[model samples]
Target: MKAALVNRKMGLFLALAGILALAVAWWVEHVLHIMPCELCLVERWPWRILILIGVVDILLPGAAGGPVLWLAVPVLLTSIGLAACHVGVEWQWWPSPLPGCHAPHISGHTMAERLASMPLLPSKPCDAPTYLIPDLPISMSMMGGLYAAGILVAFCVWKYRVAHTARRIFY
Candidate 1:
């Protein structure tokens, strides 16, 4: 009974956190007028998936919430990976796998055709890092990676405690 309550609370926390992360990203892009690179856009997907999982975890029966919450671990891991890749691109460690991260190659010979081939909105290059804070050296991707890692650690600790309690009860 207590486990279920804890799980529900955890789920709620995760869902809210994910929503906040997305909202901040949107605010940065729309309100702050900061353009996100293709890789930055790609990094948002895992959080969306995590939010869905979190919603499910909240809706499920208390006993069922634990396993559903477990699903977020892998999703968070994926988020961390995406953030790392984006950070790598920002660091110029390697080229971005996303084609949109690169400049569009207009092959059309005619001026009209070239204009049509051009992207509707100019894309920010992946290598360019956007610092959220004035003096902070950390980029958005690095912050995301850190946040994901922190959540992952918390989940692991929760799982360990659950296992420890179960062992005490069974043995």
Candidate 2:
């Protein structure tokens, strides 16, 4: 019916949203050569989960898919929380939760000992925010938080419409 078609369309939209966010992140990191902090890397997990759930919902029957998409609500919330944490770190409101977000301090008396204690890989500090544009005044994490909030609002509206229509159909 019409409802099923709408559900499938929303599922596709949600899947594409996740894909777009990840794609931008990849492009920023690979194409632009901007390194991501540990917290930035951590924030992507919710999107990945959303992508999986959205794809599953798209594959399922319309009625069944609705509930699956509901699972994305919490995941989106988590993403928002992660983004806020990142923003806070960037603004110096608080330190990052991840140890990797901070530069490791190598303590040693001898040169050989200091060299041995140094980390093998380079890491970007979470407090240093990456701006996508020159002097944009908005960090990537802030933009991500806003994007997640928008998606959450859209999903809520979709669910509300579906529920209202169901009431009219049943009652």
Each candidate's lDDT (Cα)?
Answer: 0.88, 0.89
Mark the 10 consecutive residues where model 2 has the least summed lDDT.
61-70
**Candidate 1: Cα lDDT at 135:** 96
Candidate 1 differs from the real structure by a C-alpha RMSD in angstroms, to one decimal, of 1.7
Model 1 residue 10 CA deviation (Å) reads: 1.5
C-alpha lDDT of residue 121 in model 2? 79
Candidate 1: the clashing residue pairs are none
What residue runs in model 1 are displaced by over 4 Å at the alpha carbon? Answer: 165-171
* Model 1, span 74-161: residue lDDT tens: 8999999999998888988999999999989987889999999999999999999999998999999999999999988987887789
What lDDT, from 0 to 1, does candidate 1 have?
Answer: 0.88
Clashes of 1: 0
